[model samples]
Target: MAQPPSPHVERPGPAEVRDPLVLTELKRAGVWAGVVLAVLGVIYLAEPLLLIIGGLIFAVLLDGGARLIGRALPIPRGVRLVLVIFLCLGFFGWLFWYAGTTFAGQFEALRQTVEAQGAKLLGWAHTHGLVDEDRPQMVTQQLVGSVGRLTSALGSAIGVITSAVLILALGIFFASEPRLYHRGVAWMLPLRKRDFFYRLLERVGFNLRRLLFGRLLGMITEGLFTWAMLAAGGVPFAALLALITGSLAFIPNIGALISGALMVAVGFSAGTGTGVWAIIVYFAVHNIEGYVVMPYIARKTVDLAPAAVLAAQLIFGALFGFLGLLLADPILASLKVALEEWAGVDPHAEEGEEVASPE
Candidate 1:
């Protein structure tokens, strides 16, 4: 009963999109696709990116030292930076000259000790019914294989040396004129966003410097305490253990576990008594650093949540390997600063500082 069949009209499908509303929807989908592709790209290029991050972290360390030197020296920035570099070089030179052969011997011993201890542990676990008896050897083999893979993931000895040199070079360049790089980065941003980016960068730099300073303090305290305590107790590998502990202390929870494991293993190489003492020393050193040194430092720096850092480390380490684990905390700290800035929080606000109340 319709008047004549309505004129046949072909309407555009979503795929043929002509309406502005449809165009907007298409743009949103395109953005999501681009984001996915970008993530894939990042995963593929993670190694070089991680190296860059490592360089930036090193730059932060150098810059922090330079600043500290500046406080008392009243010297030019470049001069202070140069002096810091020389001091570092001199320390390392002295260390090698003094203990090069000793360290070389201890390192071989340490490797053998760790492997023996690890095998013993697996055996103990199997005997205790913790690991399946049939698969005990398999588990140990897999553990060994995983370690091999981790080492290879970082590359061969030459490659590792090359990467370290590159990082150091990049750090020097970046620390030399950070502001230039800052401006260069900001120049790439949209005009409206540049201000925010600049502010975020400033906050990131400030937080990183403070974090590294606190970390340095912790490392020194832990190393000295461990060395002194272990020496007094006549623990085997006292010097070597202290060195490892101090270096690993730069890392957080995981580092402590690793160093403690190594220490205990080496300690047991001497005897059960020494091993017990090693365990005691581990707890005592960590407890003092955690409860005493770090808390005071945290009040003056960017205090990261332990869980947050651990989570980041696991994720990054899984995705990108060792370098990722090393840089995760710094990356997280940077992200934290950016988030706070995004949320309109004041970057310079002290913890527990009061906000003004309206009358």
Candidate 2:
């Protein structure tokens, strides 16, 4: 009775045949598609991404402060972090309270002085036949434009304040319990890759903390020395110039040039003697920091090539704006560390390794 017309009939499935074309082309195409999408996504989300990066950097700073305090206080990390935050806020408040109006006036004077100096420079160039008469005004305008572009990345005041607030808030949250976020990130990654990711993070934190500590030390020394020398030399806007120098030192190569130029310009606004003194002071401070201090710090931490750092700065500055420019070095350093780890090569090993033949 043929099982009385069974409720189900079985049918043979199709044979599992190999692909006519190899998977190599398909895989290459998929990878290219993925890369394209990622690039588009990054461009669209540049602002938020930059803010997040800023928060991370700031968090590292707060963490460093907390760790330092812990060495002395033996207090809870949360309390230490709060103390660090309050100290920073107090310093900023003091800075604004002390110099806000003075800085404003000095900044305007600085702009006028720079423009006037540029005009005089063009005149001299023209007189010496170094610049064509027709090009002088254009050159001056370009000079002014470049100066303006320094802060153009900051956008409007409201935007600046908003970004700062977000960064600070994010930094506080991240610093309060960085491990939670670290583990969260690891959880999303493959189990096999999680350990590697954590290792990379630990290495990154170590390098970043050292790098920033060295930077802060340099900033303080440079600023104080600059202010003292300029004030003694009777240079115009000594306080303002020192502040600029100190703040800009956070940036590496390009920043030094800008601060030096501004200092010299303001010095000239006072007199030729002061201008010469300014040049001397600029070189004296920077030469010591650049040739002595920073190299030692670089060796102790991550020693990135000067050319690589400048290139990263240019690219980041172009792509993401001022915050990007500011973050470029740290980001590059982090990337270098990550890549070295991924390649299974210890970045510092080569420097200290002893070469001994097998016995």
Candidate 3:
């Protein structure tokens, strides 16, 4: 009796106690998960919708500043919003028109260069023994075919007008009635959780807006610098190249390389001297961007880790394709905030103290 003193019992920690419930819910909601998967699958299938949603999200992030501007200015919010929208439309329209005109003017020159280079390239390959006598023609043909396919893909515009319209509509709705969405979200939660949920939404929205602004600033800088270099070096289609580079800048590492390589190729096609100059200019610009521009912009914007961003892009891109790629950072930022909050970690915790917990 005394020797068999009542064994001490220890209570499970909160997480340990919650595990079984979580597991049970997961098991019970396999059907719900399946439904979610089906819905996401359908969304992916409707690529245009996905793109429109993405564009709307981008617009919301970019135009959030319009609210502050409206408040501070003499103009009403609605008038300020209209002005921002008009400015955006006018800027993009001008870019499109300029790009179109530039491309059209350069098309014949590009075609001629490609034709001339195709023969010269094959001859050089043969002379340098890069290809066997029997394979030179086949290899050249393959190269040409590859280029043709790439050009076709790049030139094929898809749902631009429709996506623009939808994005504008969504942006207007979001700007006009953002509180409605916040209220709707808050209403979805219990009374006790509503405040927390609203805070989460606010954090998410802030992070998204910050990320967009940072990216926009970086892209503008990159595009302007690249355009200036190209123009100085007498590269054809400098404006178009800048536009393309700026657009692709949203894609991160791969985008920069692709855009830079294309610029070099365009330079090469222009002439040897021009090509050399373009290469030097681009290299210098990229170095400046990577070392100076990106770091500053990232500091000012969202404090996302590069690795986190890359990992998110990879995961989401795998799961949802292009839309997923576009939404990856925002999604990851949201998840990061949620994880931090759930783990009782401060959202504004110091960099060294930041800890990511298991989902």
Candidate 4:
């Protein structure tokens, strides 16, 4: 009675095509395989992974700089980024060209002064009975052995150069298409998780940007103040010392110690008066930075405890050496952010914003 029966359509069997359960199983397997591969990759190619992280950090720095420039001038972010990069390159280039000749001489003098100081200190140690005169030969042997190890270790300095190049290239690429990469990272998470992760990334980016800004400001302030003070006080190699101090300031606690010691030693190389002035300048500038500038900035951003940072530096330094020490604070900060979110804690909660209290 009805119209002619609808034409029969052949459906493919599970074997001929695919089954839903089988597809789901396959997807799970593929995901597990990917996870395993990634773990293995990190273990085997740690240097490259570190370089990638370095590149990301560098990109963050570039992005942060561009944002500051953007606030001052109305321009496209891309153009601003390019200008910031060029400005940075120009600055470094000028620094190198400006001080190349002096740096060579100063560095040589620094080496000789360090050796002289070392001998003087050792003699003092012997006179003060800090060293067992009975084992004088042992002390010399240990010194020579340590020097040998250091020189041998420097043989791998080429690896550092390669890593720098890798970081630069990767940073430029990442900075160029940040949004694309950011979205791609979000896409890797489940739909429900993506939103939370997106917000997490936003906070991280903001914190890192702020952290780097504070760091840059502190470095410049310390370096310039140091240079002016030292130069005015007639400290030899003032510019070079300031440059080293600025570069090392990025490394936090250990860096300050090293820079301060180096500057003091260099200062003493000239005279007692110069040495005293250098020490005074170091204390004044760094105290203000450590107490005033850094505290104000950290309250606004990183908020990491100094002791905790030093501990992290120790752990990361043992695990990954110099680069780890450099990145320890940021890594710890990111970890803190993740933990707070996981624990359902509000980082910026006010007094009235407490969820629970003694009623």
TM-scores, in order shown? 0.87, 0.90, 0.73, 0.81
Clashing pairs in 1: none
For model 1, the superposed segments whose C-alpha errors exceed 4 Å read 1-18, 92-99, 132-135, 347-359
Cα TM-score of candidate 2: 0.90
**Alpha-carbon lDDT, every model:** 0.83, 0.85, 0.71, 0.80
Of candidate 1, the 10-residue stretch with the lowest lDDT total is 350-359
**Candidate 2 vs 4: which has more lDDT:** 2
What are the per-residue Cα lDDT tens digits for candidate 3 across 163-219?
557766777777777788779867887887776676666666776777677677778
Q: Candidate 2 vs candidate 3: which has greater TM-score?
A: 2
Candidate 4 wrongly placed segments (more than 4 Å): 1-43, 134-157, 352-359
Clashing pairs in 2: none
* Alpha-carbon deviation at 146 in model 4, angstroms: 7.5
Between candidates 3 and 4, which one is better according to lDDT? 4
Clashes of each: 0, 0, 0, 0
* Top-lDDT candidate index: 2
lDDT of 2 by residue, 1-359 (tens): 35564559765556643565646677888999999999999998887898999899999999999999999998898899999999977887888777776687777778899888877877989999999978898886887686467456678788788888899988888988999999999889888787778778988999999988988888888899999999999998888888889988888888899899988988887889999999999999899889987898898889989899899988888788788889898899899877777767675776755322111
Model 1, 1-359: lDDT tens digits are 65864569776666786789988998999999999999998989988888888889889988989999888989899999988878866876787675776788888888998888888887889889898876768987887786676555487878777877778888888999999999999888888887777767777888899998888889998999999988887788899989889989988988899999998888887889888999999999999988998788767766778899899988888788778787888898888876777776654578765322211
Model 2 residue 141 CA deviation in Å = 2.8
